[model samples]
Target: MATSRDQTLSIVYSSTATRPLNDADLSALLAISRRNNARAEVTGMLLYRGGRFLQV
Candidate 1:
């Protein structure tokens, strides 16, 4: 019998928001990101702090 291995890849990145975003802006961003991610089979987390963003 033979065994097979699985392969996977990952990347991490961060960026700063060019402008301040209000509640509405944040909601819109989440909605758009969720749709796009679902289609791309991509899964990750997002963190917001002091106008900065970190995604992995």
Candidate 2:
């Protein structure tokens, strides 16, 4: 897809957490993230692997 100069392109960024999160922490994070994302019209997925998080 092509975008006009006046329009900004949407990009996907991912990051890994510095440490592992417990169940409670993860739940709280998801809850807050969902709320914020919904309000901002943001959509993405999160992956937990080997004590780290990959969010995009």
Candidate 3:
């Protein structure tokens, strides 16, 4: 049997950045995202290329 807490939700989305992100900016953004997601017990992957972002 599976309880509500044992179920997990998954989401996938993509977006274009309004402004380009440099290496430093991208690194900082990823660091913050990792920290926050860890605190919320969430796991996923993020991809950035050509000023676009894809998160799953």
Candidate 4:
């Protein structure tokens, strides 16, 4: 069994993309999660409202 490097990523997106995220985007996000977890990183959530990004 392969160990999971990427724990998880929870996102609440706003102003949906012209094209919703596909497989590639999902893979990339997973990669980020792994890298973050490895370094004891704090993964932040970005909120887009009125074209502004709010980090929470």
Candidate 5:
């Protein structure tokens, strides 16, 4: 994978109001990450392909 200056790193949960990730989505996905702290983590390579998904 590659990194970019404008690209961002993220860590989201199903109940994350800020991350906007769903529990169903997490269940069928592949992920690798490191711990930032309790109830907070960091994620990488979250590819957002074309879709009707609204992330805000």
Candidate 6:
């Protein structure tokens, strides 16, 4: 009985960082992202490598 608008959705995003992020920077970014996503009731995974980011 679900319409398109009522269905769960998935997204994939990729980006390149202008500058490399250090451990502390990555940690901080993750903390903030987790907090924001939690507040929005959103869940996904993040991957970073060689100045690139992938979110799903």
Cα error of candidate 6 at position 24, Å: 0.3
Model 6 ranges off by over 4 Å: 1-6
lDDT of model 5, residue 13: 27
Residues 4-36 of candidate 3: C-alpha lDDT, one tens digit per residue: 779999999999999999999999999999999
Clashing pairs in 2: none
The lDDT per prediction is 0.86, 0.76, 0.95, 0.59, 0.40, 0.94
lDDT of candidate 4 at residue 25, scale 0 to 100: 69
Q: Write the per-residue lDDT of candidate 2 for residues 1-35, one digit (tens) a residue.
A: 65564455466555677777788988998899999
* Ten-residue region with minimum lDDT total, candidate 5: 30-39
- Which candidate number has the best TM-score? 3
Question: In what order do the candidates fall by lDDT, top score first?
Answer: 3, 6, 1, 2, 4, 5
* lDDT tens digits, residue span 1-56, model 4: 54555566565544554455666865786688668866976666654444344454
How well does candidate 3 score on lDDT at residue 44?
97
Residue by residue across 1-56, what tens digits does model 6's lDDT show?
89875778899999999998999999999999999999987889999999999999
TM value for model 4: 0.37
Instruction: Show where candidate 5 strays beyond 4 Å.
Output: 1-19, 30-56
Best by lDDT: 3
Please give me the total number of clashing residue pairs in predicted model 2. Answer: 0
Task: Give the Cα RMSD of candidate 3.
Answer: 1.1
Q: In model 2, which regions exceed 4 Å deviation?
A: 1-14
Which residue pairs in candidate 6 have backbone atoms (N, alpha carbon, C) closer than 3 angstroms, thus clashing? Answer: none
Better of 1 and 3 by lDDT: 3
TM-score, each model? 0.82, 0.64, 0.89, 0.37, 0.19, 0.86
After superposition, candidate 3 runs with Cα above 4 Å error = none
For candidate 5, write residues 1-56 as lDDT tens digits: 65674567554423223354566655444332233332353333434333223222
Clashes of each: 0, 0, 0, 0, 0, 0
- Lowest lDDT 10-residue stretch of candidate 2: 5-14
